[model samples]
Target: MEREILLLGNPQLYEISEDVKKEELEDLRPVFEDMFDCIKGIRRDYGFGRAIAAPQIGIKKRLICILTDKPYVIINPTLEFIGDEMMELMDDCMSFPKLLVRVHRYRHCILRYTDENWEKQEMRMDDDMSELIQHEYDHLDGILATMRAIDNKSFVMKKYANPSLSK
Candidate 1:
C-alpha cells in the first residue's frame, strides 16, 4: 500500500516519536515496508528523496528508511557525532510537492540503528548522506524541514555562511 506523506505544516512532523517496543516489531515491519515502497516510488518518479520517516508518512513511529547504495531500515535510531560543519541543500518532498526549500544540516554524523532483520548496526555518514540521515531522523522526532526551511530569498544571504549550500 502506498502511504500518504504528511505535508510540511502537519502537526505530526513536529512531535517527538516514541520508540518502537518489543511487541510492535511485527506490526512495524510491514509499516516499514510500506514506507520503503512509498519512498522508492516517490524517488523513482521525482528523482529526489534519499530518506523518509514514519511520521512523514503519517505513521507516527520512530522508524525511518533510507535508500543508499544499500537501502536499509533504521529503527529507533540514535544520532551522535553531530559535526560543526554544516550543509544547506535544496530539498523537496513528496509531501511538500513543488516547493523547494533550503535546509541546514550536519555535514557528518554517526548513527546507531536496528536493521530490517533486527540486527543492531552503527554507521558513519558524511556529506549529502549525513544530511539525509539527519533529515529523516528529524521526521522520526516530529520535525519538518519548514521549521528550519529558509526563505527562498534569504537563502543567498545564508549561503556565504555555509558554502556547501544547495538549491
Candidate 2:
C-alpha cells in the first residue's frame, strides 16, 4: 500500500494518538510495513527521514517505527528529560510535511519501548539522532514541530524553503 504522505497544515497532524496493545502491534505491522515502503520510495525523492509515526501516515495510534535499521517499534511512547541541558534544534516533520522550525530537544534520550518481537527494551539517542527520535515520537503524540515552535515562539519557515522537509 503506497500510503500518501500527510502534509503540513493538516488538522489530523495535531490529533493525539491512542495507546497500543501487544495484539494491536500485530494488526499494525502491515501498515507499518507499507509506511516503510512508502518512506523508502520517498527517501531519494525526499532526503533524510530516520523516523516516522503512525499519525504521520494518517493513523492516530501511539505507534512509531524508527529505522536505526536496528529498528524500533514504540507503542505509547513519551518524552522526558526536557530540561536546560537540552539542545534547541531546527527540525522539520514528515507529518507537518513541510515547515522547518527551530525547536528545543533533548541532547540525549532514553527511550523505553517494545520491539517488533514484543520484547521490552530501552535505548538512548544523542545529537542529531536524538533529535530524530524525538521528532518522530512527537508524531506518535500528534504534536508537530510547528506546534513546538508555537509553544517555544520559534519561527517556522514556509514550505520548500527546505524541500527535504516534505514527506
Candidate 3:
C-alpha cells in the first residue's frame, strides 16, 4: 500500500504503534522527511497544524514531528501530566482535517523522549504546548481525539468552532 496520510477510517490509525529503536533512526530519515512535508503541507492547506504522529502517515512507529519555530522530533515519547488540573479545548488532527473534537487535556505536562540526534530530551509544557504534545502522544497508543470527546455534542466542523485551536 502507498504510505500516505491515513484518514479517519483507516484501520492503520487505530493500531497501536511500535516503539522505534535507536538503531533504526538513520534508516527512518526518509520517513522523517516525509512526515515534515506532510505536516507542513497540511498546515499550509488547512490553516493549522502543529504536529503529526507516525501512524497518521500509515507508519506504525512511535514518532511525532512538531513544526513550530523549528522542528521537534519526538521518538518513543511518554507524557507525565502535572497536578490535577485539566484544560478543555477543541482538538484537531491531521488524520481528520477540519473535523474538530472537544476534549480535556492536562494543563501541564512533562514530555520525555528521544530527539533526532538520539539524545534524551524533556520539555515542561503548559497551555497550548501541553495540549499539542498530549494530542500527538495519544496517537502512539491508538487513541484519537474523537474517542475522547467530552460528549456527543463535542463534535464540530472547523468553521463552526467559535475559537479554534492550532491542535
Candidate 4:
C-alpha cells in the first residue's frame, strides 16, 4: 500500500490525530508497512528522510515509523523535555519536501511509548534523534515544522539551504 503523503497545505494535516487503542495494536502492521515504504520513497526521490508519521499518510493515528539502521514503530508517544537547553537547526519534512524551516528544539527528551506488542517503553533521546522524534511528534498534534519556525526569515527553499539538494 503506497500512500500519498498529505502535503503542507492540506486541511486534514491540521487536524489532531487520535490515539491508537490498545485493541487495535495488532492492526497497525500494514500501516507501519506503508509508512516505512513512504519514507523509503521520500529518501529515494528527495535524497534524505529518516521517518514518517501516520498523520503524514492521512491515517489520523498517533504513530510514527522511524527508518534508520532498523525500523521502530512509535505508538502514542509522549515526550518529557529534559531541560531548558535548545538548539536551532534547519528542519525539513515529507509534507513539504522542498521547504526548510529554521526552528528551535529541545536538546534532550524522554520519549515514552507503546511498542508493537503494546508494552510500555522509554528512551532518552538527544541530538539528531531528539529532533527527529520531535518532528514526527508534532505531526500527531496537528503541528508542522513551519509552525515552529523562528521567524519570517526562518523559511527557505531546501536547495539553497543544502547545496547537495541543488543537485
lDDT of each: 0.75, 0.72, 0.88, 0.92
Off by over 4 Å in 2: 96-98, 150-167
RMSD of candidate 3 to the truth, in angstroms, is 4.0
Displacement of residue 115 (Cα, Å) in model 3 is 0.6
Q: Please list all clashing residue pairs in model 1, or write none if there are none.
A: 13-142, 14-142
Q: Candidate 3: deviation at residue 9, Å?
A: 1.5
Candidate 1 vs candidate 2, lDDT winner: 1
Task: Assess every candidate by TM-score.
Answer: 0.83, 0.82, 0.92, 0.94
RMSD to the native, candidate 2? Answer: 3.5
Which structure among the candidates has the greatest TM-score? 4
Give the candidate order by descending lDDT.
4, 3, 1, 2
Where does the lowest 10-residue lDDT sum fall in candidate 4?
158-167
Stretches of candidate 3 above 4 Å error? 1-3, 160-167
Question: Runs in model 4 with CA error above 4 Å?
Answer: 160-167
RMSD of each: 6.2, 3.5, 4.0, 2.1
Better of 1 and 4 by lDDT: 4
Better of 2 and 3 by TM-score: 3
Candidate 2 lDDT over residue span 28-129, tens digit each: 889878777766655555554667788877888877776666666676765555355778877866654345788888887777777777787776767887
